[model samples]
Target chain A: MKVKVGMMSFAHLHADSYAHCLLNNPRAEFVGIADHDLRRAQQKAEQHGVQAFDSYESLLASDVQAVIICSENVKHAPLAQMAAAAGKHILCEKPLMTRLEDGQAMLTAARGAGVQLFTAFPCRFSPAFQQLRAMVQAGEIGELLAMRGTNRGVNPGGWFNDPELAGGGAMMDHTVHVADLMRLLTGQEIVEVYAETNNLMYHGNFDDVAMLTLTFEQGIFATLDSSWSRPRTFPTWGDVTLTVYGTRGVIEMDMFAQYLRHYDDRAGRIRQVFWGDNIDALMIDEFLRAVAGEPATTLATGEDGYKAAAVAIAGYESIRRGEPVKV
Target chain B: MPYFSGNGLSDTCPRRAGNLSSVVNLLTEDAMVKVGIVGLGTMGRQHAEAYRQMPDVQLSVVYDRHMDRAEAFAQEFGATVAHDLSEFLKGCEIVDICTPTYRHTEYALAAIQAGKAVVCEKPLARTLQECEQIVEAVHRHNALLMPAHVLRFFPEYRTAHQLVKAGALGTVAAVRMRRGGDFPRTKSDWYADFEKSGGIIMDLIIHDLDWVRWTLGEVERVYAKSLTFRHLEHLDYTLVTLRLRSGTIAHIEGTWCDPGGFRVSFEICGDAGMLEYDSQQMVALRVARRAEAGQAGGVEVPESPAVENPYYRELRHFIDCYRAGQSPEITVEDGMEAVRLTLAAIESARTGKVVKF
Candidate 1:
């Protein structure tokens, strides 16, 4: 029996990738797409050769067993709560929700409905990160000491630049992936956060640059450069790189480094054509396996998303107070 | 080349022998500027080589507490050895203080008081207070003082600065500068001691700190993390984040722990375009040698050739400023500001707080 999955909205850019994952997964049935903008829903549905529902309520009332939430940062909570009330599991895009209260409400609603609430953190499925975790766990780099990471990207200047829809700027958009990865690597909670955020690039009210200093509960510290600093002419979208310093040695991981440099005269710019494993497909497969009553240990849960979002939330507070704030 | 024009020499040169016309005649007749070097260490040898290449500069005296090292250096450079600081200051028209951080204030103050032009190495001094003393001495004595922040003379860095100033990358948002190498092994091993050398932040990353301040504006705040408090033997690493007054964010990483060869790189990201340079990728030449039997493999050395050496350019600029009776491009105040920013970073790392300027 294939698990039926519907997508909630196409506000986030990741919705297209997730839709393709569901269509390609053999154990899953791509049901339909529903968005407030019916034309967008129909357009995407026509592209995928699937049904288009006029309202999210109609999609919820369908026979789909699970739904993927890919709405804006602020809409994750309401959409997921509605899905849980209708007895459907959820795979929400990160960050799980914009505010802590919304995250808590989502977790409570999922628990009350007895449905799985998984956060989509595709980086956990990266082969490079998996090897790094294995080496560190196997005592190849000794005790963990510190780390430095970067999750920089070119500015996505749509709803992402709107402070209301995006919750914040680069700090909200980028910090969670690496924050979740840091937790997964150290197996510790972040205790404190100090951040410096500015909007020098665009001079918009929303910040385009954010530098965060995170201190873990286990006495380890790290810095994250979560900035929309890459220009439009960059070879690729951006990068996720982490350098782990330990007592005995160091391990560096560039997650999306498996690529061929394509210098095309036609395009008039260099480009990186990625040939790495499709991490989104891997993450979707894990979610389907869990729906099929199998264990998914590597999956990021609602709590993991909540903790990572808490780090970013504290980062904003630190910026306001001009000091480090405890998480 | 006509090295010294002797125009406006009477106002700045305290040891002028005669009236303006006679001084001009004397300078044009014999344009050799006698230069002295103190502390026969790495920098002293480097400055000696640069001076040897200049036609109008004569290396007159060399001094060090270790007389044997000074004697060897003077013999190789065909210069005389000064027995004491007084003799060294009297023998030269220009004094280059190449001593370690702890001795910078002493040598620079004495050179300034003796009314000789001074070229002091980076960091200015070990502490901000010591830097202030040198600044005050230069002002009080009306002496010529130039801090050797040689990154300004490096072609790559200069190109980057010019591009940013010219708005090649429009409204830069963020920058990352990295510099690191294995722990330096010196004769006294002072670099290993945090108190004496101020570790990597003061001794090494000050180069980037000064460059960023020069390119951008004043830093409004600083936050940092370092392994200096860990007390790891012979190893230090630091990461500093600076929020510039113009709102550009700069991240600087300095290390004395990388065993792989030295590396320097920078990335500037702006709205219109991006600029990136990595030393590891820009190598013009590389040489690798096979290991002999019963011997470890020889280390590979990568070289990137430039039109002119940055150190030579820096010294040449200093000499021009001295001859014109004008201040250098990198003034004593600029050196003090770099020291202040570095010290603030160190304080932030030690206290785990954001330090404001």
Candidate 2:
């Protein structure tokens, strides 16, 4: 028996990618999709040959045993709680919640209802990142001293720039990825953070970019520069590079370095394509595989999402008040 | 493909912003000309060392408000220590002044009144009134005055400038330059004083803004935002946006919180292809595809700093102008114009409106 999966909305940009993954994965069946935007929902549903529902209540009442909630960041927590209550496993996207209290309640509900919960942060599965982690563990990089990582991009406006809907601007949008990657790669909780956020390019109400630095519990220092203001001419897939200076040797990689092949053979020449497409689907496939008792490492645990949220939100507070904020 | 001049210029003509060559051919004197340095601070000493490197340049005198600083530079360079402004200019044909902005008017007038050539450090004067005063003095004396705009001497920046000029890329459409560094545990300290640094735009982005203007043409209008974003007891960062008279737009970022030491990058976009270069990267020159091939790495950036510093090249250029009757890489007008645009940028940032030149 295959696991049945349904998506909550076409409102979130990555939703269609998740739906395609579920339908395409032999181990999972595409149950249905629901969204306020019927045109978008219909477009995605028809493209993937899946059922489309007009309302969340109908989608939630479906026979699927699991749900992937790829909604506006603010909807992540509430939607996760609803899915957990419906006796369905949940795959919520990062920024588990903008507010800590909501995130705590979602975790509490997941535990009380005995439902598994995960957040979508697929950076951990990158082969290069995994290689970096193994090298650190093996003492190949002895006593990690410092690290710098940048995940910058042009603004993906819509809900992303809306502080209320996206939780916050660059601080909320980007710091979580680095904070989680920090905990994932270094195994140290952030002890303190001092940050400054800038609205250098996009200025009316939102800060389209932010530069943040943190001190981790284990005495390592790291800097993460995040932005939604990278020039549009930069490769759309974006660049996330990590440079770790260790006791033995310094290791650095343009994470997209491995993406040096042609995806379209008919084209005259190989074009530049950075990210592995279908990441949303790929992460979903791994989560479904884990639930089926297949071999799998932990997907971004709700705890991972919670911590990333705490630190990301704290960084926002620090920028607002102009001081360090504890996580 | 940009028709890059082997000389490192784009299709643009000479006597403009954003052009330089990497392979160094320093000024050598057929006949040595006497030179004097008016300040003995870090920048002043760099000026002296630069002069000493030129075979045709002779350090005639050294003077600083502080006698000790002046005497030290004089002894190191085998130059006489000048007791007063008149004595310094009497012996030297050219005067290099690196004094604070307020003092520029005092000594620059003295040098020009004595009919000596002059090179002053940037922010040529404390205010527009002072800049105008210096300009009047230069015109009054028919005195040659060059401001030390050393960024023009940076090889990579020179290439970007020339690439735009030579028209391999057509009219330059846009430019981006970034200059930043970690919060210096040590700064000039006086840098924190509002009157001295002229905030971020004048102190830092002035260099990049001048580079932008050099690459494109003159800026017709400017908009800027500034803030003390970090905890260094100063205005730590500023970003300036420029609209050139030629319809090019430029963005310059200047900050003191790189948090990892200095980082510098410059990029220019044109209709046919774009050129981008960074000091942090292995490849400095990137061009669009040419007739038969894709854009090639036009030049290789050394991982290490150039064996000869840019300041050295700038001083050599000055010496060539003074002794060999050669034109400087960055002439006096370039310096004055950079200062002019810098003051306009500061005004725009302060008033929160577009400032026109």
Candidate 3:
């Protein structure tokens, strides 16, 4: 039987993409969506041709075997806990939760309830990244020495700009993706983080530009530019680029560069029409497979999410203390 | 003209007996400014080539502690060799010092003390103290000195600077610059000695550091990481994050680990738009040759032809400033500041902490 999956909320911008993935994945049954704001839920549900539940609790009470927690950064913990309590597997968003204690609590709830808690890090499913990982594993680039990554994007000015809801700013929102990728590629944990954050673009309280230097456990170092520095008129959202330097060779990967550049005078801007694999759908397929009792080796677990988020959390602390902090 | 010292021809001038005619020709070219080059290394050779291309600048004299190397260079460039430091100083009105990091302060101080305009290679000196010494000598003697921060002369970087100055990208938010290549193979491999060259952060990323300070404003703080401490053989890499006083964050990466050859790239993002340039993407020609059966392969060199070489432009600009008796765009103070910033970055990398200016 197909694994039945629902979405907990439409509060995140990725909720629409996840909803579309669920509807299109052949091995999963797309269930309804639930949100605190019924109108927003209803709008997304109707647009995706799915049912809209009035509340998250009602959605957890349904027959869905799993639920993707697509709520705001601050609400990920509670939603995942509720889903875990209802015996449903959970696929929480990028940051498993904003706070360390909340992430630990969510992991504990899932483990005690015997349900899987996967973190949504779709960049792991990128084909280019997959090839990069395989090559690195195969010793294409010999003993890894250093790495540089960037996940810069245009500012998504909504609840993301609200520090309380988003937990932090560009450092919090964008650091996790590349952080997770680094973990997956190196199989090492980030031990220390030094960061510089500024909001020069918008001059707001939330930072729109962040630069981080991360030190790994084995003495390897990497620098990450996790900034919302792309302008509104940029061709695409931004870029996910990683250049890994090893003893033997160097590999550069631009995850979303397989696109046609389209300049439209009507829209008064240039746009990138992507022709790459559906990374979100690939992630959802892995989630469903894990839900169906198959091994999902590539899926980002709750611990991976916590570790990546810890890097960003320590980044903020480093910025506060004006020094490098241990992660 | 007091610094000219009569076409620099003296009894000590080491012009070969067979090359007397060339020496006479060099002395008779009164319209040409006599230029002397010190150190026969890669940068020294590049400066000689640039001076050779300038019709109004005569490659008058050459000097190196190794007399054989200086003799060979002087013969090829149609110039006389100077065996003595004081005689070399007297031979040319402009002294281009392209020695290693440790010797920059020595030559620059000597040239400035002699009242000759000086064009010294980047990293004006090895340390802040040395850079300050050169700056002080320039002030004490009222001498003209220009640090050869050649990135300011590259057309691509110049365009980016101009665009930002013209507000093409409104309210710059961030900048990223990268430069790297294989470990340099020099005559002495002095670049491998961190004490002498200060690793990649000092010798390499100082280019971007100066460019960023020029385009952005003063740096408030810096955090950096590098493999210089690892003591790896023939490899070094560093990444530095700078917080500009104008609130812009700049990340600069410098590497000596890339085996695929040299690459330079930068991205500037602002409120209005973004500008990106990658040297690998701007290749106009590439040549690849197959390796012999038992030999390792040769590296494919990609060439991007420019209207004028940046080194030529930099030397030309310095010469023009010397002729006009005006301070150069890159003053001795600016070069000292670049050294200060680079030293700060090196400190941050070693201490693993944020260094505030």
Candidate 4:
């Protein structure tokens, strides 16, 4: 059964790119698109060769089984609720919900509608992450131990700058994927978090840099760094790698950068380097397979997204109190 | 002829003991490989000098922001000066980025794009994403990037890594590394600012993160406590605790506030052995254990002057990688991991809390 997919909007910068993936996907049929902004929608539609509709209702009612909501961060939960109520499976862009209750509300709606709700936290599909997970599960590495990971990037202002629209800046948008990956790979619920988030990078906007230290249920201590404040020229899409120290062996996977190669011809020479994560295509492919009901790969379930939301919100909560939050 | 065939092991034939010249003789092959320096700042110059007059390699050229510096470096090393970025790159097959943190990406990217192999200083990039972009560029262009986690190439760290990898310490039970030093004061006004340099933890302690991760694997969580006081006043000093996916615990105490002096050391305690490493102290393996007959557990030490300068080894590895079209020892991905850990440390520091890995 082919999963017919429709674009909910083109409000986010990466909306068109996500639509392009669907457009090229075999298992998922690219239906049509809907956005409140007609001109922008039409422009995106024309660019992607998909039909554009002035109203979301028209687009939602089209013969599509699911909708990938590439809408604003704030609208995610509300729109997800609506799409779910309409019996449509939802694939929404992340930070799940800026607020914990909103994430729960959407989760409730999806559960009540008896449909699947998939949140995008693509790092879980990175090749390095896959290898890490394999090592952890297979016990090739040994007893679970303390580890550290980082995912920092330069600011992505635009709508992300507006607190109301994007919920939080880098703290909200960036931490979700990493938080989700932690729970998925380690199988440990974060029990406590001491974190600090600030806007140390882009000239005193909302805080876009975040540092989080975590104590998991198993007493596995770890740290997750997610900032939109990375200095511009540091190579490889902001790094995300986990260093897993086990009883038997230690494994380090630069989920995004182990396969980095570049040509340095300073001395008439070409150089090759491996970077991190060879899983963007694989992740997208996995998403399609999950949508197609292919044994349901462990994705960012509403639960997973919800956990990230809870922890992230709690991180903010702790930040406000200048204290640590025990989960 | 390069004698690059080191599987890093004991072959039942014990060579001469505790001698630098003998060590060099034992290690080198017949040919003196040509090497070049890119981004001729302090590191570029140091690496150039490190490689100059070496039995293993010859200094080919030096490239820098200032053509005069490049020329001066060339004069000093009897090498060539890259008149421009393109020309300099064309003359040297080996490129090193000692550029400021911000310029790291551009210089590295340009070098890689020009078909040269590279060795970059830490943090890969300010962001994991930038590292990923560079990594992608490397893949698309077929280039090699060896992010210099020079500590890994150093004799002490190399030995420690071997013991850990060989299970010298049964299974790694815990790790703690401490590094404290006064900030350079003025790499730039940007270094004074936390944004560009990523503060002391990202800029300095990150050395530990790279080495620890290199020794361990992935971290499951991080609980960090940090402050910005004393040395550099505004620069941060941090203590980060890491839990790996394998349940091994680790901690790092880092500071840009070392008013006393520079301190660099790490201790790895496994089930079997407890090992320690400090550059200022001992450059060889120092393991301590419970001694019999009321003699407290004392360090079983290896003799010193293990003077294998890892920075030079790192650059040589980069050169070998570039010349051979092989994978580098410390890759961009490794840099990315270090970047990610740096960000996570910042996150933990910000919230004054523990963070999920």
Candidate 5:
């Protein structure tokens, strides 16, 4: 039987991508979608050929075995709680929640209800990162000393720039990906975090550029540059890259480099012709498998999401205190 | 594509910002301006070559503490050698101080006292005190002073600046600039000595510091960290975070640890779009339009116009400004500000705290 999967909200831009993954994945049935904005949800559902529900309760009342929470950062906890209480498996987005306490509540609710909860961190599904992780695990670079990562992209505005909805700015938007990746790859918890954030590029109300230095348990350290610094002319949005330095060797991975440059003079621009594997599809496959009895190794638990969010939440605290903070 | 002659310039000429009618008239009236150069180092040689290529200026004299280098440079550039500082100032209406940072004030003061326009290579001077001395000399002697913040003359950087000014990219939100090179091998290896060259933060990254300040505005505060190869050798690296008063943040990274050639890159983001240039990519700058209001727009990586030698362009602007009886594109105070900000970064790295301007 195909796993029944539905989307909660289309507030996050990733909602459509995840929906497409569910539609395409033969192992999962595209159930339905529900959003606070029913008209917007219907529009998205029409494009994906799925049912649209006007209310969260109505969608949960239906036969959705699993629900993907793709709402604003602040709304994640509430939405996840509703889905968990309805006894549905959950796949929440990057930031589990803006607040650590809220993230904890979502985890408690899902655990109490005896449901599987996953975080949508699809970067782990990229073949390049998978290879890098494998090599690191195999001790190709010996024990890790330091790693440097960058997740610079074009600023995706909307709730992302709004502190009320998104919770923070570039630091909040970008920190979780690299933070989670570092923790997952090294199998170590981040012990401390120090961050420097500012809105220098657009001089907007929120910060768009930041540098976060994280120290992991076992004395591993990493620096993450999370800025929306890519220009419009870049072939792609930007890159999620990591350069890992270990005792024996070094590993450099550009997760999005598997693309051919497509320059169209008629359009007066260049575009990336991606030839890489569909990471979203791979991630959705893992989620469905985990929904069954067996689980994937790279499967990100709600605990993984909470740990990453803890680092990011503590990062904001460090920025406020003007010093390093423990995670 | 349009190559205008030295004296004949159109209103759209990239050389001047505004009406060059006054400059044209002044150029027609004045003789080819005689320029003297102090210091026969790499920068001095570059200035001499650039001036030699210009029809509107004459490289009249060259000087260095080591007279052999000066003589060698003068012979190649068709200029005379000056054995001393004052002798170098005697034959020219303008002085290009390409000396070590510590000697900038001495040559600048001599040129100012002699009532000549002065163009000093960047950082203005090594210390805030020396920078102020040069500024005071400019004020006291009523001289025209231009600091060579040459990045402003580069086509890609200039285009980015013009786009921002024209509101094409909207408001700047963040910037990331990187500049790196192998350890400078000078005759005295002056760059290795922190007291003289102010190391990589002052000597190398100041170019980016000035460019960002020029494009954005004043830096409100700074936090920085660095790694020095003093224990291993002479390499140096620094990463500085600058928060602008306009609520923009910038990260400037500088390193003298490159095994070979030098490179510079900048990425500027705005609300509407972004401007990026990476020398390592060896591609034209990339600009992207915001996907807005249901419009699906991707990036536009257009080929950039041919880049002129910015060293030549910077010198040309200085000469043109001097002829037009106008101040330089980069003022003495602008140079002073860059030095102050860079010094503050050094302090931040030392004190392990943010330095507010």
Candidate 6:
């Protein structure tokens, strides 16, 4: 039986891409798109040739086996709770909620409803990361001492800049991806975090640059450079690179490395022509497999989302106190 | 080409002045300024060669404590050998102090006292107190002192700074600079002594800290971690994070690892755009689109015009400023600021705490 997937909201930027993934996936059926903003819902539904629903509740109550919650960050907990109560599985965008309590509540509700909740961490699906993980598991590098990672991208403005709508700026939007990756690679919880966050780019009320240093309980240390430092004219978004420095050797991987350099006077600069495997498609495939009751290893649980979210919030506290804070 | 006396060094500066005699039309020998070089090390030899290329600056004398080395260097450059520091300072109107880091204060102070313009190699001195002393002496003697922060003269870095000032990349969000080289195997092995050379953070990454402050703004705090190869014998690595007063954050990586020959790269990320430069690249400045819409789009690789060696550019700037009675691009205060940040980095690395400005 094919998994019936309905999108909860069109508020997040990735909703359109997720809609395409659902429609294209062989094992999943695109049920419909729903949003409180009716025009957004209708526009996205029309673009994807799917049905449009006026409210998230109406769509959840329909014959949907799973829902992808791509609502504004502040709306995540409420929508996920309702979806859980309706007995539908969830695949939510990163930084699941602004508050730890809210993320915990969402996870609790999902657990009580006997439904799976997958957090969106597509970096786990990158082939480069897969290779790196295999090497680490095989002790290609001896005892892992430190890992350095960066998820720098161009700033996505509008709701992303608004603290109320997006939860935070670069620190929130960019941190969780690498945070989840670090947890996955080390298999150790981040016990302490120290961060330096600032608004050097826009000088607006939100942070555009952040550097987070995480110390794990297993004595592994890592630094995450999570900033919206890429320019709009940058070839692609920024990159997701990880450097695993172990006692024996070092392994460095750049996730977006498979690209040709293209230069034209029209653009007047060199741009990366990406022809790599679609990581997002792979991630969605894994999520659907898990939702369809197949044992999938790459699925990021709601608890995974909670841990990463909680670490980011603690990073903010560390920034405020001007020191490292316990997670 | 007439030298434009501002940031437009791109237009008039020759990309390749390696064959300096072929490019320059010399002024009358008597009308030229005479310069003295105070050491005969790698940096000292480069300064001597760069000075020899200048039509209006005469490479007058070369000096080193090791007589044979000084004699060899002077013979190659056709400069007279000064047996002592006082002899070197006597006939020279300008002195380039390229001695070991610890010896900078002694030679610079002597040159200033002799009423000569002074060009000191970077880190200014081993400590902040020494830099302040040099600054005070320059003020008291009314002398010109230009610290050789050569990155300010590098064509790629200068272009990045111009773009930043022109609002081409919007406001800078963060900066990451990397500079590394094989261990400095000097005559005395002074570079290996942390007390003398101030290790890699002081002697090497000082250039980056100065450049970052020039590009971003004043640094407000610093945190650092380092790895020393067997108590910093021949290799050392440092990673420093600097928070600037303008809210810009910078990651500066410096190493004295033996493998990589010598490499430098920087990426300045702003609100609207980003300017990237890697020394390994043929075209240095890769200016990206404004930050908006989807992710950053097409990039523009500005033609990295060949230019005079940065060392030559810096020396020329000093000589031109001295002749015109104008201040240089990098002032004593700027050198002091770079020093302050480096010292803080060292302190932070030792204490494992963020050193606030």
Top candidate (TM-score): 3
* Candidate 4 whole-model C-alpha lDDT, 0 to 1: 0.69
lDDT (10s digit) by residue, model 3, range A72-163? 89999988888999999999998777789999999999999999999999999999999999999999989999999999999999999999
lDDT of 4 by residue, B1-357 (tens): 132235432222222233335445755454446556766665676677556524456677676767766777788778887666787677666677776676788888888888877778876877777888899988899787888777676666777887788887776655668776554553344555676777777777788888888888988777675553223333345668776776566768775533334667776655454677765665355555665795421111113443334555566566555556678767778888898998888887676555676
| Ten contiguous residues minimizing lDDT sum, candidate 3 chain B | B1-10
Range of the 10 consecutive residues with the lowest summed lDDT in candidate 4 chain B: B295-304
| DockQ of each two-chain model | 0.58, 0.05, 0.71, 0.03, 0.32, 0.47
Ranking 3 against 6 by DockQ, winner: 3
Q: Please give the TM-score for the first chain of candidate 2.
A: 0.92
Q: List residue ranges in candidate 3 displaced over 4 A.
A: B1-28, B285-304
Write candidate 4's Cα lDDT for A190-244 as tens digits: 9887666544345355766566777689666676766664433334345665665
- State the weakest 10-residue window (summed lDDT) of model 5 chain A: A243-252
- Please list the C-alpha lDDT of all candidates, in the order they appear: 0.88, 0.70, 0.88, 0.69, 0.81, 0.83
Task: Encode model 1's per-residue lDDT on B1-357: one tens digit a residue.
Answer: 222222211122322222334333444436888999998888888788777766567899999989999999999998999999999999998999888888999999888888889999988999989999999999999889999998887777878887898899998889999887667777788888888889889999999999999998799999998988888876777889999998888999887766666889999888777889989878777768885797522212223664346676678878878777877878899999999999999999999988998
Angstrom error at residue B33, model 4: 42
lDDT of 3 at A158: 93
Per-residue CA lDDT of model 5 for A1-327, tens digit only, reads 999988999999888888888988889999888999999889988999989898999999999899999999999999999999999999999899889889989999999999999999999888999899999999987766667788988779898999999989888888888888999899899998878777756567887777776777876656688887776566788789987765555676889888998888988999998899999889999999988767667868999999988887887898898776889
* Strongest candidate by DockQ: 3
* TM-score for candidate 3 (chain B): 0.89
Q: How do all the candidates rank in terms of DockQ, highest first?
A: 3, 1, 6, 5, 2, 4
Tell me the tens digit of each residue's lDDT in model 2 across A67-91.
8887888888778888888888888
User: Where does the lowest 10-residue lDDT sum fall in candidate 1 chain B?
Assistant: B1-10
Per-residue lDDT for A30 in model 4?
A: 79
- What's the true lDDT of residue B240 in model 3? 91
